[model samples]
Target: MNIKQYLDSTYLKTAQQANLTEMENTKVVQHFIQEAIDEDFKLIMIRPDHVKLANDMILKHKSKVLIGTVIDFPNGNSDLEPKLQQAQTAINDHADELDFVINYEAFKNGEITLIKTEIIACAKLALSNKKNIKFIIEVAALSNHQIIQICALIKNTIIANFKEENFANIFVKSSTGFYTTINNLPNGATLETIILMLENSNPLPVKAAGGVRNIDDALTMIQLGVKRIGTSVAKTIADGHVSNENY
Candidate 1:
């Protein structure tokens, strides 16, 4: 299986999070971007701050690797304005894809309108810019029912407001790869959750982010109908090796 095509080789940690100096952290991002270019992975998912760096490298090499950056990151609780602002910046930096963390917390709090509005506004921005967009639902923080509901919500919202051709550009992604779960539970896409997402999202597409560790995991997700897999261990998986990293 040509697993590299389905992988969004990810590195989203900040300097502080990675316990590295700013320069050191940037070096890591640079190395990842170069590796993605060399390995010909589908995309490189990085923090918003590094989109320009990735874009510059891709341009220099005239590579086909796409650039993806996260908006509102691990926490999707931010107000819509902040998310829009962040996404705009990423687009300005020439990011090919924008993955926005949806306000899942509002959905959990019975704020349906808030969640719907955010989806519509942010999605329109990305689509208008001709950029691919993914809504990270953070499945690890939700129940199975919520997962299905949110997936349907995202699917329905896009279908209702956007053209049919635009549907392919939007995706209902599974997680941010940064959520923390109790009792060491899986903090990302599990088989069960991917099934839920696939069954509900339909033509909207699904991206199985987080917890996908190896070739078998990547293959399983693709077989289950996930169009993309966001993982930090893209190289190991591409090499057919199991990754020991939890994410």
Candidate 2:
């Protein structure tokens, strides 16, 4: 596995605070972000409030630093209007991509039409800025069968929408940090989910996240067809042995 490609393809997230006085904590977070980018990370995801700081770093480094902002992050409990507002705000702040969580309960409740409508609305919001959208499925919450069904359903629906909208990519993502069970696995079901999605998707990219802590793990997920990794452990992974390795 090529380490540089994996590093460059990842979307690293940092701890973010909502205000300027929280500068110290933001600086600490940015430090790790800088180290990862120095080692060749091309994208970074952060909370909306930290966009200014991240933008500053992106300008300073003269690197291809893509800024991604989460919409209804970790959990997808917000109403459609609020989520759209968040997406618009992130775009207004210059986010290159939007990581939006799908409202799974709506889908499982047989609200497929409604779910599609919501996704379309979000997709349109993102498209208005010529920004890309990655839908987080939170794979740990579903059975394997359910996961496949969701993948097929969304791939058919959302990818078509992206095509009709003339955007290049509509991504399917697995697990947000909200699912702690994945954290317990020796190696997560990240690769497994990506494999399933790839087998089922048309051209949508897959983001395999949650507990991806080292080079081997990241590369393994990538080999299984993941185009992006959402993580905070890039430095540790990029530097260490990545096998029987100590962080």
Say which candidate scores most in TM-score: 1
| Per-residue lDDT of model 2, residues 19-123, tens digit only | 434566666658755865676665676777766677778778886767777788766867899999888888878888888888876777777887788778988
User: What C-alpha lDDT does candidate 2 achieve relative to the native structure?
Assistant: 0.69
Q: Per-residue lDDT of 1-247 in model 1, one digit per residue for the tens? A: 6789999999999999999999999999999999999999999999999999999999999999999999998898888898999999999999999999988889999899998899999999999999999999999999999999999999998899999999999999998878888999999999999999999999999999989998988998899899999999999999989987877
For lDDT, the strongest prediction is: 1
Q: Global lDDT of each model?
A: 0.93, 0.69
Q: Least lDDT summed over 10 consecutive residues: which range in candidate 2? A: 9-18
Looking at candidate 1, the ten consecutive residues that score lowest on lDDT are 238-247
Give the lDDT of residue 99 in candidate 2: 85
Candidate 2, residue 177: the lDDT equals 63
CA displacement after TM-score superposition, residue 25 of candidate 1 (Å): 0.5
TM-score of 2: 0.83
